[model samples]
Target chain A: MNISEERAQAWRADLRSSMKAKERTEIPRVHMPELDAEYRSHSRLEEVNLGLSAEQAMLEAKRCLDCANPTCMEGCPVGIDIPRFVKNIERGEFLEAAKALKETSALPAVCGRVCPQEKQCEERCMHLKMKKESVAIGHLERFAADYERESGSISVPTVAPANNIKIAAVGSGPAGLAFAGDMAKLGYEVVVFEALHEIGGVLKYGIPEFRLPNDIVDVEIQNLQSMGVHFVTNCVVGKTISIKDLEDDGFKGIFVASGAGLPRFMNIKGENLVGVMSSNEYLTRVNLMDAANPESDTPVFKGKKVAIIGGGNTAMDSVRTARRLGAERALIVYRRSEVEMPARLEEVKHAKEEGIEFWTLHNPIEYIGNEQGRVTHMLLQVMELGEPDASGRRSPIEIPGKTELIEIDEVVVSVGVSPNPLIPQSVEGLEVTKWGTVVVNNDTMQSAVPIIFAGGDIVRGGATVILAMGDGRRAAKAMDEWINKKS
Target chain B: MNKIVSKEYFSANVIKFEVEAPLIAKARKAGHFVMVKVGLKGERIPLTIADADLQKGTITLVVQKMGVSSSKLCALEAGDFITDMVGPLGKATHIENFGTVVCACGGVGTAPMMPIVAALKKAGNRVITVIAARTKDLIILEEQMRINSDEVIVMTDDGSYGNKGLVTNGVESVINREKVDLCVTIGPAIMMKFVSQLTKKYEVPTLASLNTIMVDGTGMCGACRVSVGGKTKFVCVDGPEFDAHLVDFDEMLMRLGGYRDIEREENELYKEALSSK
Candidate 1:
């Protein structure tokens, strides 16, 4: 079928479905997917939701009502044109909606899939005043982005003529990609250096494919490449080429967006056991290297009874991945109650649906190994929530003499990560915090060295993908003004 | 990237690369060391600065091929570059005028001790040097030590070289002959332990350099920790060089053995892959 005819048919379907449109609501309505006949029979990593059909997408879009002064955009970290994109979808211009999103977000497809829109953009929707369902903004956003990709002809933003201004970005994650894209639009020659063999720092390595597919991330990277940004992989800036060397190579400005990749371990007993591993290493082995394949060089251990320790989004992803890896039973061992879990509500719900057992109020004390030197079981201490701590959440206090032994062959530690100290160690005269994170002006991302700027996980230790992209946008603007004034 | 100031081969397994590092070369003294990585995927290994040239802005690193990382580094030629190199880290050696000082070097230890002997002689003290190895083939820096010391002795375990005994044997002979004011030893932990024990009988002050597991080569990681004088100290920032009599050699030896099994397995896997190809 012709492209225009197919779009026209979709528009007709949307118009026919407008007669059954519901009244505006206060709370954002969660979209439920109709189970696929074939996928329900077979379990695989394919996307669970087939996405809202064209008729459903239009009905959801009409529910937006196009607030004159939408506060939803203010809640978005990347400042995506929430109302404008929703308007495009209402008019059946799915291609234009994708373009509106790409104007700000460097990874719309990723954010649409994983971002917690209920807490951010959709939280401030006007429809929520009357306690009715708000528009399904996140689902529609994903539809527009996926439509553009499947169509194979995405509309890219036009770049200005090259101004011969060179800038170097030290990472290839969301922050680095955002800064590079913005700088390239302003006619600056941008080059991104990645320490690993593959690009997309944590996006490609930390998050599992079942949640964020590698190809979806690759498409976003390809879009950036199409905009005249160059990427050099396997080059660690602080080690392979120092900051001073970049300046000497005629890079007038440098934006260090090296995300925090160092894994932090609790100094408890049995932490150094053979079965214990950081989420960073385990996820990297599975996502980047295909370690699940038995024929691969680096095969990851597949345990029959696996226990993942933590309650964040990474914990959810790890537990779900273990289930897909043929583990008969998978569990999440967290110290806090279900209400205090750091994972998004939707993720927690999906994890429960996938048969992942949650052992809340349980903390691992030690891992016991067998005679042959392999983890056979773990000793866990039961706990209960007490008064709120500094983070405004109730802390878990151990209950004496309530320890239990749970048999498990593997344990993936998803506690947290720290900033990599490579950049601060290499650059002299730059001040770094005791945690090894670069110190920068909170307002402007500039460091003690006027020519260098840093942000993202390297600055904040750990943050969401959208927050990192926000820092990138701010650094690009600051850099552009600083360079223009100097000239 | 820094330029190579000088390069020389001390033995089949050891090579000294002198690179230009003005900041380190200026502040470096006898006992300071540096950490280097040959390239990406290379582990950080600590090496003592065998010598320094302030005028030429260079610090020398004498490396012996002991593991995978070091063997890869030893294979590099004169002009080849290392991916990263940092610091004249750890504490500088304590230099003072004791009437007479005896310096002992074993195997690769001769390279680092050459600078201490030279410094001790410059401090107006009588410096006696003893160099030992498993055999004559392993002994290095004999001529360099002779130039820096008032008297020099060479020993080997197999009796293929100077005196047929360990380095501690030479120390016993020197202690029995004269009243040594201070003794400095740099070698394996076991050798240093015995040297400290032998010197305890003669009532002489003994100093030894401790080699510990280090990651960042900075105080931030707290990996290179050791107990000295009944206090825990970070080797990277506190003292890679410490009083041999007060060091807890037993704890250091146990920590070094922690990763033996993993390393052996990795090495075996690496060899099998190489042989198959």
Candidate 2:
């Protein structure tokens, strides 16, 4: 069928689906099966969420009202065709649904697990308007992607004829991977340089195994690799090879996604103590280096009392990881109240179920260390919520003369992170903000250096996986257009 | 992949290897170092570039068997491939003719100091070298130091070498005798601390090369942050070298020993596994 005819037929199918709309609305949202909280918390290697069964996925897919407008697509960062994929699942064409997802998302499996769907697509579900729970869009998306991968019928997206124009990406994180995949499908020779030994930047290091397994990320990377994208590990772009070097080697374009790997620490006293470190260090050691294994070259210090400071997803990951490492008491000490936390509601709920203590409205003022220089205790200031701040969350103000000291052995700081300064400082003439993020045209994601572009945590400072992927996709389109126009 | 072309034993636990890395060798300078990973699971550890031959496209790395990563790196023979090596990291040392420069280094610290000494001598500075170790057998690169330096002084803790005192004693004697313009010290944190103290008392400008813990030697992780002049600085990007007077040695020492207990345990377990095989 021709393009316009195909679109018309799809719209007609959506209209015909109104016949069963009453039955579909009556089908309640399918509850996702999960590993027992107590059992899964201790099992560091096993995934917590047992993916939805095929039957469960189809029933859940039925719950989608298949709205004529499909506001869910507007909520998605990569703008996946929600109705097409959901309807594909409803028809039991699982692989077709995955193919529909792959048309936009480069790492659907990863985003399915880590993305905050409640705040995004699910929130926009039409069922919410009827005072009912939203359709399980995220869960169904995960089922479709997982089913396709496990069935061994993975499909490679079509690629255009080899344009043979060389391009490079600085980091193999979500943003870089997405950019590489899109550029490759456009028939460009793409190369990604990773400073770490492994790919999947934060997905491998910053994230723990129990939440998002390494194998899932590896499969996504393999898909990109099959698309003819090349990866060079242990290569620091600005240091090992300069931006000038890539140009000298005849690369037509470069994408700087060397994420915000620089972890931020609270500049409070005793932060430099032996037992205090960034969440990046703690997670990288356990997840990437196998530091839990005593025989590993670098073993993480297993503490009996661990306190992770912050209210973000990373703080949740750190506190949960500490629990798995045998901490007798694991706590999340956040400056603001639970309502103002930046972590996903699912993560917070899981952490509480795993017996993680929440010391909400408590901020660490100073860390006390023993003579041996290891963290021994934390001095916390009681905080109360005040007027809303710029981020629209209530600001936390310290209560005068109300403080408490708690004994702790280890502390993981998860305040936030600044951009990785390598690319910004190394690439001359590339404009950067006061926060060290590269200045790029919003429409194109192109930096002052016309041949260079940037995205991901390096551009957003700290953001979700899907947002970074969106940046990568946008940059690829802009880079391709710029290259074609120039030639 | 950088291949190990040659390996030589500097001492029982110390080793030196010449690896093939044309880009790193061409870009390297005196204070620049590389992050080397022995195997797929091995952690990346920073090692100073003792020397580099541009023509041969190779760089020399001196390894001391202190932990599992270092021991694994030292066990490899000629032709074994390194899974990963990325570098020419950190800012190069500031070289100039500061007349009468004393280069005090201990044990493995002597390796990173070799290039600085050569650079200083070529810059017309009369370099006085003080090489120290726990005993005579632990000392290394004596002939090379003697060839490049105007004078070489050996100090062993057990009095089995040139002098019977610590490195501080040798460095102090030189300062008392002649006009010492500058001092550069590298080694254990404790040794550098004392050398910095001695140089401060003599009012001589000094530089200490810090070997802090680092994950990605490209300023990604803040594991190698050190307090300098009351401000936080990343050793990977800000420096591997800083003014001795401004460094907080005690804090750096504690941070360096953050993994000491676990390291010792792992090293013992690894040795047991190796011996059983």
Candidate 3:
């Protein structure tokens, strides 16, 4: 046999032996350390998961069989070479594993820290067939990516010689950043325009720091910058500049990933109360500004009794944030059962662990306010699950003669979001759906305008980070083909 | 960014700018309004389309610097560009053969009222327009209204112009002399409410343009919403122009005051910035 094959076989044998040793070992599972006792921390933003130790990481990596044809790669939206990267981690080649992951994902660190692997890669793990716990793939991925960043061993993807083609990316969210990364690697001059003062769209504003640290996002943005991508903040595309004007400005193609920033609320009674707010405004204040800080210029209203209405990840984030903001009782008022919740399982679990109250099957009917026009309590109607709706989840039907009044000083509605109709309204003849989403070819991500492309939450109403990144990759490929065809 | 072709000061705090928006210019008609944002941080402000030149591919907007957002927009020079401008939004005015139509405009309302007066005149109606303000310095679109109407009456509360009284006094005088077919008013809620009440007594058809709190200028956000005839309608999409007699002006006035705290804070910041400079 060849020397390389012999070495590979020996390495595999060593891995299998270590894994067996770990299975026989009677060591207790090491729990994550608690926060420093002095820090007043009731929220999940304090980074409760201290991460697996080096020994734990090695043991977890050893659990992988390094299957000949790993289904985990197929499950990943970005098609990351999962087995190869996991094998590299087993060999203590964390930098190599990170490099392999970066070859497919533009923001490996962010995704590894946020993506739902239980529903994606780990769900397809072969070890599951043997009634054994799957390898800790998500944790290992995070470790590899984090190790690369901390060790300063990040490698930039090679770019071809500069091409004259210039593309404009609207919004600096995950989709836009991913598209810019791929396009820049193809040697196209790409510039991203952001409407807000910050660069990351929902990342900097919508998401709280505990889940995905701002430093991690900043590092990813810096990496994109190093790859020759130009970002211009405080530039609202449709408002500051129209799509037609972009063409006039010499941009050959435009990709819009503006996101669904427009927040939606239930058109119920008392929505206009002083303490009612959309999740967007609430998270923006807390995440963008230090609204929790008493000395900050834009201090948000602090309420002792806060109730966040929704079953999505945003609702979880908002409820946790309310807890951190010193709410004596923060609750999640959802109309769905726990199994039907739309939030990530990890987030739901963390929220429950952090002592967040869940008032399931209760829908707010109206908000009662004092004479001064401030919300004092919310009238809730109890609900019971009925037959499944079109979405296949049982609908919550209101129960007659069962009403309750819950004292709540603040109400954050995170029900859903709609597309920001700025571009669609400004640009004539661009067909938009009744829901205000930009109509695009699902395959090519191209809108009615041949020169304009769109994706992400702006197209899907609302979606996850990995799904948006997948859209970005698809658009990048389609945009490359379109530009090449024109030339 | 949308390019600004030309900017002219129509009054002390009011300015007119011609912007290159071919699509909006072509589609825009009288009484149609557009939402504009000056910069990234700027709030979306809806302004009436004062004029549109299709051949020149431009639309004119007359803006009165009042709130923090408007002041920021006014600070832009002639060559400066705005971040966003979306338009010809809300329902366009329905102009028909109302035999004798009386149009009343107050302060910046004259800009939005000018096109309706011209449309009424073109529809074979005898248009009599009353341009009213606190003083002659506040009155705008006098010349445009004169050219668009068969008769134009200028009024001021302080006796600084043609008639020395409120616009309702001028209207009452004209109504006593002739049978008014229709009355269209564009002004503050209080003024429009009084006009609607006066017209209701005479049983004349009245239409008033309601400028409520709007964010997207589309029906999506439902921020610029109002109750009309016991039904809720969004000003951004349903009608910035609605039947004054049916509108619940009290609710609209209440909604307008919803952001008073934010507005005051922003204004204070602006004043601090100006004084520091």
Give the 10-residue window scoring lowest on summed lDDT in candidate 2 chain B.
Answer: B214-223
For model 1, what is the alpha-carbon lDDT of residue A216?
92
Interface RMSD against the true structure, candidate 1: 7.8
Clashing pairs in 2: none
TM-score of each: 0.70, 0.97, 0.77
* B69-101: candidate 2 lDDT, tens digit per residue: 998999899999998899888889999998999
Q: Can you give the lDDT of residue A480 in candidate 1? A: 92
Q: After superposing candidate 1, which stretches have Cα over 4 Å from the reference? A: A1-63, A90-92, A130-134, A234-242, A288-306, A321-329, A366-377, A407-410, A425-436, B1-277
Between candidates 1 and 2, the TM-score winner = 2
lDDT of 3 by residue, B1-277 (tens): 6788898897779998888888778777888887787664556678989888889999888888887778877878777887777766767899899899999878888888878888889989999999899998888878888897999998899998899999888888889989899999998888888888888888888999988766545444455667789666667666888888999887677667666775677678877888999
List clash counts for every candidate, in order. 7, 0, 5
Model 2 CA deviation exceeding 4 Å by range: A1-7, A10-19
TM-score (2 decimals) of chain A in model 2: 0.97
DockQ of 1: 0.08
lDDT of each: 0.78, 0.90, 0.80
Please tell me which predicted candidate would have the highest TM-score against the true structure: 2
* Model 3 chain B: ten consecutive residues of lowest lDDT: B214-223
Over the stretch B1-277, how does candidate 1's per-residue lDDT look in tens digits? 4456566787788788888777567667789877776654555568888988878888888888776667766767666676656666666788878878999878898888988998899989999998989999888888888887989989999999899999999988998898899999998888888888888888899998888765545443344555677666667666788888888776666545544655565556656765898
